[model samples]
Target chain A: MNRQSLKLSMEIARVHLVSKPKQTIVAMLGVTFGIGMFIALVSLMTGLNNFTEELTMTASPDIHIYQEETSSRKSILEEINPDGLNLVYHQKPKNETTKIRNAREIARLINLDARVLGTSPLVSSQVFYNYGPVQLNGTILGVDILDEDKLFDLRSKMKAGRLEDLLSNHNGLIMGKGLAKKLNVALGDRVVVTTPLGTTITLKILGIFQIGIGVVDNVRSYANISTVQTILQKDQSYITDINVKLKDRNLAPLVASELQSKFIYKSEDWQAANATYLTGSMIRNIITYAVSFTLLIVAGFGIYNILNMTIYNKMKDIAILKAMGFAGVDVKNIFMIQSLVIGFLGGIAGLVIGYGLSFLISKAPFNGGDIISLDHFPVNFDPMYYVVGIVFGVSTTAVAGYMPSRKASKVDPIEILRGQ
Target chain B: MEPILTTKGVNKFFYEPEKFQVLKSIDLTVNKGEFLSLVGKSGCGKSTLMYVLSTMDTDYEGELQIAGQRLTGKSQNELAAFRNAHIGFVFQFHYLLPEFSVLQNVMIPALKLNRYSRKEIEERAMTKLKMLGIDEHARKASSKLSGGQQQRVAIARALINDPDIIMGDEPTGNLDSYNTQLVFDIFSELTHTYKQTIIAVTHDDEFANKSDHRVEMSDGRIVKS
Candidate 1:
C-alpha cells in the first residue's frame, strides 16, 4: 500500500523488462497479434451481420398482415361396393380464399397505433400482359401510390418518370424495367392486362423502375387501388394484404406477433421470413469470439514462458532483493508489473493496428455482385471490441505471470548465496 | 552496553543427499557498536551461522533475538520487515540489480522500509554513496561500475536504512587487496565514528585479526571468541 514501495516495484519491473530486449519483444508481439486479430475479425463479422440485416429489411416489409386462408368443401359421391348397394359421400376442399372483408377499417386501426410509421392496402392479382403479339405472365398489384411509396421508399428506385404520375392519371401504371422490356413498351405506351377472373384492363405505362433483383423487376407492376378493384369486381373496402412499416425496424417481430394474437390475420415480420440469416450471424459471432479468445490465451502462454525464464535467470537478483527486505508480495508485485506493462503497451498497439486494418479493408476494392449492398468489404468500427481486447489481454497476462512471480518470491536468498 | 544481537543453541540440518548438521548448538552475543568477524575455513559452518543470525535462514532450531525483538519462528514477511528495519546484508557477490542505477540500487532497502518519502530516501541514498566515495557514479547502472565500485555501492545500499547491524558474508571476497583494505576502513569508520554495529564473515586472516572481536569456528562449534 506504500506509494514508494509500489513505485520502486514498478521501477524494478521496468528495469527487468528493458534488460532483455529480445525476449520482451517476442512476448509483446504475441499479445499484439492476438489482440489485433481479435478486433479485426470481430468487427468484420459484426459489419457483415449488419449488412445482411439492412439488405433483408430493404427487400421485405417490416410487417405484413393478411387474411388467413379459408378452405371450402364440395360433396362427392363414391361407390361402396361392386353391387352398388350403398353409396358414400365425402367432403373435400375445392377452393381457398384469402380476401380481407373489411380491410380499410383494419388499416385505419393499424395507422392509429403509435408504433406504425405507415400502412398500405394491397390487392395483388396474377395476370398476363399483352402488347401487340407479345405476351408475358406477371403480377398486377393495386396500391395507393403515396402510401405504398411511404412503405417501400419506392420513389428513390424509379428509373424513368415519377410515381406521382399514377396519382394524376387513374389509368396509368408503374411497371418494373424487366416487365416493360418484355412487352416492348416504353413510358406512355399502352398495355392490356388480363386477370384470372377474366377481367381485361388497359393501363398506360407511367413509370419504370428497377429494384436490382431480377425476379422482382421482371414480374411486378403497380396500378391504383380503385381502378383494379372496379375491374376485378371487388368491393371498395376489399384488400388482400396490408404492408406495415414501423418506426423501429427491430421491433417488427414483437409487434407482428402482438397483432396476430389479437386478430384473425396472419402476420409475418421480415426477420421471421429470413431467420436463417440471423442465425448465421449468431454463429459467426460465436466463432469470432472463440478464435480470438483462444489466441489471447496462447499469447498468455508466451508471456508465461518468457517470465519463467526471466525469473530463472534472475535468481541471484531475487535473492539479493529478498535480502534487501522486499517481502514475498513485493517481490511478486515486481514481476507482475512486468507482465502488466507488456499487456498495457501491447493492448494499445493492437488497437491501433486493428483500427488501421479495418480502415484498410474498408477501403479495399470489392467487385460487388447483384446481391450485396456494399461496394467494398464491410468493417464495423465498434469501440467495444477494442475495450474487450484490452481487458482480456491484460487480465490473461496477469494470470499467466502469477505462477512465475510466485516462484521468484519463494526463492531462498541463503540457498542462492551459499550455492555461489 | 546491551547486546544488539544474540543466538542460543542454534542448530541447522541439510536434508539434501543426507541429513547432515551444519551449525551445531552455539551460544553467541555481540554488544552495540561492535565490529565482529566470524572466521573459519570452507565448510566450517561460519556462513551458515551468519545466515541464521541474519534471519535469512529460518530452518535452524534456535532462539534468536535482535534489536530487542524475538526473530525466531517468524513468517517470511515478518522476517523481511525485521531485516529491513534492524539488519542489513552485504553478500560476497556484490549482488546489485544489474539493470538499475547505483542510486536507485542504494535506495531500494529504504524504500521497502517505508520510513521516509521518495525524495528523502533519494537524499539518504546520495549521502550513503558519498560516504562510500561513489556519489559520482550514482546515476550510472550498477553493472557499469567496476567490481570494487559495485561492492562499494552494495555497502552504501546496506547502510541506507541505517539498520542496527550491517552483516556481510565475505564482504571483500571478490575485490583486490586495495579494495579489501578500503572496505575494511569503511566498516571501521561505521563502527567507530557512527556507532554502527557490523558482523562480517571472512577467510582473510589479516581482515579478521584487525577487527574489534573475532569468533573462529570449526566443525560448526565456536573455537575462539
Candidate 2:
C-alpha cells in the first residue's frame, strides 16, 4: 500500500521477468500481434466504409424533394351521386406536371433554415444522344453549375474540363465517361440531343466525369439549367427537383419530413435512398470488432498461461517471501506488476507496428478499373483507434493476470516448507 | 527474564486425512534473549507448535501472544506485518529467491517493514551479511552459492530486520556437520551477543542439548523442558 513496498514489488517483478526472458518475450509478442492486427484491421475497414459512404453522399443529396405522380382520384360524378355508380367506364386520366411548383422559392426557403447547408435546383429529362446515326437513350440532368458543384463536389470528379466551363459555354454539356465513350464524342465536339417532346438541340461536349457507378456512368450527363430548358421548350421557372444538403446528415430524415409537409412535395432522405450501403457498412463494422476482440482475448489467454506457469515455477520463492512477512497483497502486486509492464511495453510496440503497417497499406497501389477511381489503398489514420488499441491491450492483460496473481498470493508457506 | 512469547491451551487439528489432533493444550512461555530448542521424534508436533508460535498457523483453539500483542483472531495481512517487524525465519532448505542477489534477499523484509530509509536498510543488510561472513558474495545470485554459504546468507537475511525473535524450522537440516556447527554457532552468538530471542525446531540431539532451554515433545504434549 505504501510507496516503498510497491517499489520493492516492482523490483522483484522485474527480476522475475528478466530471469525468464524467453517466456516474457513470448507473452509480450502475443499482445503485440493482437493489438497490431486490431489497429490495422480497424483502420482499413473503417477507411473502406468511409469511402463507400462518401460515394453515396456525392451521388445523392441529403434530402431530395420531387413531384411524385399520383393515381386517378374519385370522379366528381361519384361524389354527387353518393353510393350510386361511382365508377365511369373508360375514364381518361388527367394530365399532371412532373415539376415541383415554385421550385426556386422552395430551395430558397429550405436554405434559410439553420440546419440546411445548401440546395440545388435541377431539371432532369429523358433524352436520346444522337451522334452520326448511333442513338443511345440516357438521362440528362440540368443544374446550376456552382450550386451543383457545392452540393456534389463535382469539380474533383471531372476528367477533362472544369464545372465552370458549363457556365461559360451556354450550350456546353458534361457527360459521363461511359456515356462519352458510347457517343464517340470528345471535348469541343457537338452531339445532337433529342428530347421526348421531339425538340432537338446540339450541345458541345465541354467535359467528362466519372461517378464510378456502372449504370450511372453509362446513362447520365449534365448540362446547364437554361440549356435544358431551351431544349425542352419550357419557361424559366421549369425546375423539376430540389436537392437539399444539410449540416448534420443525421438530421436528414427529420428535415425531409418537415420540408415534405411544408412544401407539399415528396421528400426522401439519404438514408432511405442508400439503405443497402448503410447495412453493408454496419455489418463490416461488426465483423471488424468481433475479429479484433477475438484476437485480444486469445492474446490475454497467452499472458494468463505464462503467468500461471511462472507462479508454478516460483512456488518455493513465493513460500519463502510469505514466510519473510510479505503479505498476500504484496505477492499479488509483484506478479501484477509483471503483467502490466508486459502489457504497456507490448501495447506501445503494437501501436508503432500498427502505424507502420497502415502506412504501408496506404502506399500500396490499387486499381479499381472503371468502377472506382483510386490510386492507393484507403487507410484511416485515426488517433482514437490507437488509444482504443492500447487501452484494450493493457486491460486484457490485467484481467488475464488477475487469477494467477491471486493464486500466488494464497500460497501456504507452511505446506511448502514442510514438504521440503 | 521478560516473557517475549506465551501460549495458553493451544489446540490444532489436521482434517484432510481425518480429523486428527496435531497439538494438544500447548502452554509455553519463551523469555527474552533465551535460546530455545523444540525437539521430538517425527510427527510429535514440534514443527506444528513452532508454526503456531510464529503466527503462520492461526487455525488453533487458544490464545497466542507475541511481544505483548495478541496474535490469534488477527487477519493474515496483520500477522504478516507482525512477522516482518517482529519475527524472522530461517527455513530448512535456505529458500532464498534464486533470481535475486543475496543482498536483495536480505533486504526484502526490512523493505517490507519500511521503518527505515532505503539507504539505512541497505547498510543494515550489508552489516548483517558481513556478520554472517557472506558479504563478499552479496552481489551474486543466491542460487549460485554452496549449501553452507546459502544457509549463512539465509541467516543474514533473518537478522536484517533486527527482529525480536528468530524462528527456524530445521535451519540446518540439509547441511553437513561442519555447516550445521557453523549455523549453531551463529545462532548461539546472535542470542548471547545481541540479546536476540530464538526458537528452533530440530531433530539434532547435539543442537538441542547446547541450547539454553530444550523442550522435548511426545504425542503432542511437552514431556520435558
Candidate 3:
C-alpha cells in the first residue's frame, strides 16, 4: 500500500533471508524440487520417444504407405494380441484361388500417388527352417532388390556377402546373420524353406545381413519379389502391400495421408505401426505425474511450516516496525521477500540437480534386449524446461508462504510493546 | 515557526469488541525546533498519542494535520509516503535489521523516495551516522553492537530522511544509565544544532527534565504540562 514503506519491507526481508542459513534453505527447497521434478519427468519421456522414433524410422520406412486405411494396429491388437504383428508380416500364398485378377493393377495405381517417392511390390511369406533340432520360424519380405536396399537400411546390411546377391540369381536369399548362425548354414548352402501355407521353396543362401537392431537381426530374411512370387506359385495378380518411402521423416504423416487419398488406400505411421511409444508414454505419465505431485505436496508442507515459524519468531520485530512508522503492508512484503529469496536459491539448485541426473540417465544403458533394440536412453535438454521450472519454483514458494505472512502484517504493536 | 504537528480533540479508543478510550479528546501542537517530552508511568496513553501524531494510525476521532496536509482518510499508501518524507520515529528498543549494516539500516527511509541516487542516499546515511558519533559502526551489522551503540544507530536512521518531526518512544528505556545520558545529550544537541523538532516519550524523570518542555500523563490522558 505504501510505496516507500513497501520497498523498505522488501529490503528488510531480503536481508534477513540471505543472512540466515536455515531460512534460506527452508524457503528454496520447495521451488527447486518442484521445478527439478517437472524437468526430469518431461525430458525423460521426450528423449526416449525421440530415440525410439529415430531407430524405427531409420531402419524401416519409418512409416509405410499401403492401399488400405483404418486403425490397423488397434484392430490387429484386439484380434490377435501378441501375434498382432504376424498378420502384417505374413501374406496369403499366391495361388490360382487366392490371387485377385487386378492385384498388379492395384499396386500400379498405388505407385502413382504424389507422396509415394518409391514404391516396391512386396511379397511376404512366413518360412520355417530346420537343422537337426535347431529351428527358427521367420518372415521373408520380398521386394525390388535395388529399390529395397536404398529405401530400407535393414535390407542393406549383409554380413557375409553383398546385399546385391539378392538380385544376382533367381533363387538367391539374404538371411539374417543370426538366423544363418542358428541354422548352421553358410553362403552357397542350399536350404529348403517351407511356407506356413504348406508350399516348399528351395533357395541358395547367397548372403547374410546383420541390421544391428535385434528385431530385424534374428527374425527376417530378404529376397527379390519376382523370385518369391515364382517359388510361392503366385501369378502377377498376387502380391502383398507396396512398401512406400517418403522424402521427409517428419512429414511422413502428410505423405501417408496424401497417398491414402490419392490411391484410396490405407497407410500406417510408425506410432500406429509399432505403437510402444503411445502405450509406454501413457504409463510413464501416470507414474511421473502422480509421483511429482506427491513430492510437491510434501514440499508445500515444508514451506508452510517454515513460513509459520518465521512469523512467530519475527512478531516482535514486526510490532516494533509498526510502532516506528512502518505500515502493515510493509510488514507483509517482508515475508514475501523472504519466500522469494528461498525460491530463487532452491530453483537454481534443483535445476542443477535435475538436469545433472537426467544427463547421466540418458547415457546409462536402459533400453536393451530384443524388445528394446536400442543401445542408449535418449536425453534431450530443452531450454523451455529450465524456464518453466524457475517460474514454477517461485510461484509455489510464494503460495506456500502467503497465509503466515498475512498473519504477521496484522500484529498489534502495543501488545508486543507491553511485552505481551 | 510553523506548527510541525497538530491534534485537535484527539480521542483514541481501543475496541476489542468493547470500547476503552486511550487518549481523551487531547489537543496538542508541536512547533518546529521545539523539544517536547511526554513523561508518565505505565498505563499512560503517551505511546498511543505518539502513534497517532506520527500518522501510523489515523483511525481516531478528530482532525489531525501535518505540514499543511490533512491526515484523516488518506489511503495507507499515501500515509506511508507522507510518513517517509515528513516523520521519523525512534522506538525504545533499537529495532535494527540485523542482516543490514548500520549504514544500510539508515538508508532504508531515504530509499523509499526512489528519486535520490544511490550515492546520495549513501552519503546522507553516512553523514547522519557520523553526526551521531556512530560513523565507525556504519558497515557493522546492527545486531552486533551494544544496546547504546544500536540506539545511536536508530537515532541516525531517523535523521536520514531529514523528516520534519522526530518521535522517540522511551528511546533510552533499554539502555544503561551511561547510554541513557549519551542518548539524552544527542537529543539536546539535535534541537540546539540542527533545529530539529523532537517529541519523546520517557518514564525517566531526569530525561524529561532535560527537555525544553514536559507533558505528564496519567489514566490514559495528558493531565499537566
DockQ of every predicted complex? 0.74, 0.86, 0.39
Models sorted by TM-score, best on top: 2, 1, 3
lDDT of 1 by residue, A287-331 (tens): 999999999999999999999989998899899888878888889
| Higher-scoring candidate on lDDT, 1 or 2 | 2
Q: What fraction of correct interface contacts does each candidate retain? A: 0.90, 0.87, 0.38
In model 2, what are the clashing residue pairs, if there are any?
none
lDDT of 3 by residue, A309-344 (tens): 878887777775665556667788888777766777
Task: Write down the worst ten-residue block by lDDT for model 3 chain B.
Answer: B108-117
User: How many backbone clashes can be found in candidate 2?
Assistant: 0
Candidate 2 regions exceeding 4 Å error are A70-95, A131-133, A211-215
Per-residue lDDT for B1-225 in model 2, tens only?
899999999999999889999899999999999999999999999999999998888899999999999999999999988999999899898988888899988888888898999899999999998898889998999989999999998888888888889999998899999999999999999999999999999999999999999999998999998
| Residue-level lDDT for A369 in candidate 2 | 66
Write the number of the candidate with greater lDDT, choosing between 1 and 3: 1
Q: Model 2 over residues A181-201: C-alpha lDDT tens digits?
A: 888888888999999999788
- Largest TM-score belongs to which candidate? 2
Arranged by DockQ, best first: 2, 1, 3
Top candidate when judged by DockQ against the true structure = 2
lDDT scores of the candidates, listed in order: 0.87, 0.91, 0.76
